[model samples]
Target: ISQGIIFVSLLIFLLVGSLNGRQRTFVSDTVENKTVVEKSVTDYLASKFNTMVIPSLYCIVLLIGLPANALALLILITKTKITPSTIFLINLTLADLFFILLLPLKISYHFLGSNWLFGEALCRIYIASFYGSITCSVFLLMSISIDKYFAIVYPMFSRSFRNRSKATFGAIVIWILALFSIFPFLLSQQTLYISDVNITSCHDILPREEQNSYYFHYFLFLVILGFIVPFLVIIFCYISIIWTLSMNARSQFRAKMLSTLVTITFLLCFMPSNVVLVIHYSEFHASNHSDLYVSYMVCLVLSAFNTCIDPFVYYYISDEFRDKVR
Candidate 1:
């Protein structure tokens, strides 16, 4: 396993090195030709990141995520009894499955040098489904954490509040909210023909004026609704749960691991992109320059990893799942 990790790492480094050089040459050649700079050189960083990193990361996510999420769903249904937690877990697993299923199209898009051959309509649906699944997963994780928090922190009083019907209702609300979050993106155009690059770039390239006028505000709204709100709720719930667990009894390893893993993965996957997005849109919107947009795109690669790591999160949270896996 370690050998495989090392091998993938080395392969990525090689791809990054070769692709970056080629990108630099592409820029120089374009400049020499005196063709209008269709896209800036910094934009190439995102392109390079997409070409080298997205395919590899997404491939790994696809390979592991498909079977992991599928098995998680199967186990939750067959091996575990129905309950609030089970309902939430099942929904969460389904959310991850939705996210994972969309990755192959993304992998192909990036591997083809960011040319989105899927046409405009498919691109819209693709982006919508991508963000929708992720947003739903985030809210569902918060729901699960809250369920755990109440069950652990106030077991007696929490009984009425936590039930299968309530869980199902929460899942429905989460899915609706997720769809709402990405609705603006779905309605907007996502494909652009770059005459210089001679490719139809997906959401990566958009008209500067439209981005500044519309997308900047829309994406910032997304950051608040999708990332900020859910994260704060989940973090607070986890902290309270941790303290309660530590204070009332001996620290449970699995419980604590679940908390730590969720927190770390949430921050690792979403924080960078969210932060960079806010900064880039706020500061660079009018300038029409690539202010950390490459970094933003690169950070997005980490977000897809959340789906890959989510099934393992089920392992830590569910005793039935743990035993079944073991």
Candidate 2:
């Protein structure tokens, strides 16, 4: 699975590197026409990337992520006793499954050269589900880390708070929060008819002037809450877990290995994309496309690769999951 991820990353880099040469040349020729040039470059690159790379990658993710998560969900649902951690994993699996199931629409849109054959309402639902599931998944991961921290560090104290009912309630709250956060996006006009291209776009184009301000603020809100806070929480929880385990010589090696794996997995799946999103938006507001935009878009899709990684994490790390599978 890790190798598959590395292969995808390398493929993206190679494809982007090839395109960058042409993009730089275009930018150089139109440097005198700054505003027009920036808009043109942004549109050109976005269209190309969205049409060519994104659709194919989404298909790949759909193929691998769908069945893996479905099987994991099946095992957890039918074979496992409900526990807090298992509940969290089940919710995480559900989020990934739901998100990827919606990818076929995205796949169709991109495959049609970034055209939206789907109606506006369906487009809004697509946009909402895509981001909402991602937010829910991240929060669920944070919930898992906190659960682990308590289980390892303060097992007795954790007993009262960590149970299937609380886990279910927490998952419900996360889903509600995720949906509410993206409600504005659903209300906005997500699909745009581009007369020039003779196609309707589903949510990749920049917002109109009237909507731009709201989008800017909303983008910042998502970055801080959806990515940054959860990242910090995961780090804190895992670091505490490692520190507590270090005192027990018998478990020291296990602690170090788990810490390393968790940190690497978390960073590999999310950090690059989230960091690049912040930079991309900063550049967007300045009406400049960062040189990193291509990489940013690539990383954004790469984050969805988490769907492939999460099931493996459950099988290997969660004994309940493993037993259920067995």
Candidate 3:
């Protein structure tokens, strides 16, 4: 698995390097009208960050996350019995797998200095998949926390709730919701020509006019459903679990430690990006491209790192899962 990961990572790096030189002329021609003086400092910094930093980070994620998630899936499938938590995990792994597969296109786009060589349809698909996976992963993590809450706090009631059919149904529902939530992206024209930069960007760097219309609505929807709702649910569940466990002397230590890990994982990997996204969108609506936008993009990249951290975290939390992998 490690070897496969390294090989794919190197191959992607080579592929990105080769494509980087080919798309320069197209990009140069695209931004001919707008001079450097007209571009905001945020835009300049954003362009540089997207080109230099984001692609390299994405490649690193692909290297570590791809195999890690794949191994997690394999272990879940071959070694463990089907349970509610594992079911949720399987779905999460699949979501991450699908999302990472699309990263090469993103990496290529960033590497080529935000020049989108692929047509508009692929751009829409990429946006949809990226956001969909994020939504799915967050929701599933929330589901797992809820599952654990029931298992620990109300063990008797948990038996019925923890059945395979229910877990499968929950997974299906989360996926459908995730996919449906990103439909607005599919409906929009994601690829836009930046006259200033003389390049067509896939998603992130959009024309100003386009940012106000539908993009605002899409991101608002994401903040509410994708981040806020899930954040509240996960927090409430963990808090309740911690409270319940605190009263019980037997499991308190394990519960507190587990809750800490989950909370840390969510706060570290997910919270920063979502918080910045909200702030970034607020500034965006005001037509002010603050440096916060750069911070938002950086946080977004950090969010992707969660895919790699998730499996290890899960392994630590579940003794069955750990034994199965061993």
In order, candidate lDDTs are 0.74, 0.73, 0.73
Full candidate order by TM-score, most accurate first: 1, 3, 2
Measured by lDDT, the strongest candidate is: 1
The count of backbone overlaps in candidate 3 is: 3
Clashing pairs in 2: none
Ranking by lDDT: 1, 3, 2
Q: Mark the regions of model 1 whose C-alpha exceeds 4 Å error after superposition.
A: 1-48, 252-254, 285-288
Query: For model 3, what is the error of residue 37's alpha carbon versus the real structure, in angstroms, after optimal superposition?
Result: 10
Model 1 lDDT tens row, 123-178: 99998898888888888888888899899989999998888889889889988888
1 against 2, candidate with superior lDDT: 1
lDDT of 1 at 29: 20
> lDDT, candidate 1, residue 52?
76
Write the residue-wise lDDT of candidate 3 on 1-326 in tens digits: 22243345346434533331210001111245652222653255347677888889999999999999999998898888888888998988998898888889988888787788989998998888998998999999989988988887799988976899999999999999998998988987777666555677666555455565556677778877886677667767777776887777767777767766776677677766655555545444343444555666677788898888888887866788999877
In Å, residue 97's CA in model 3 sits off its true spot by: 1.2
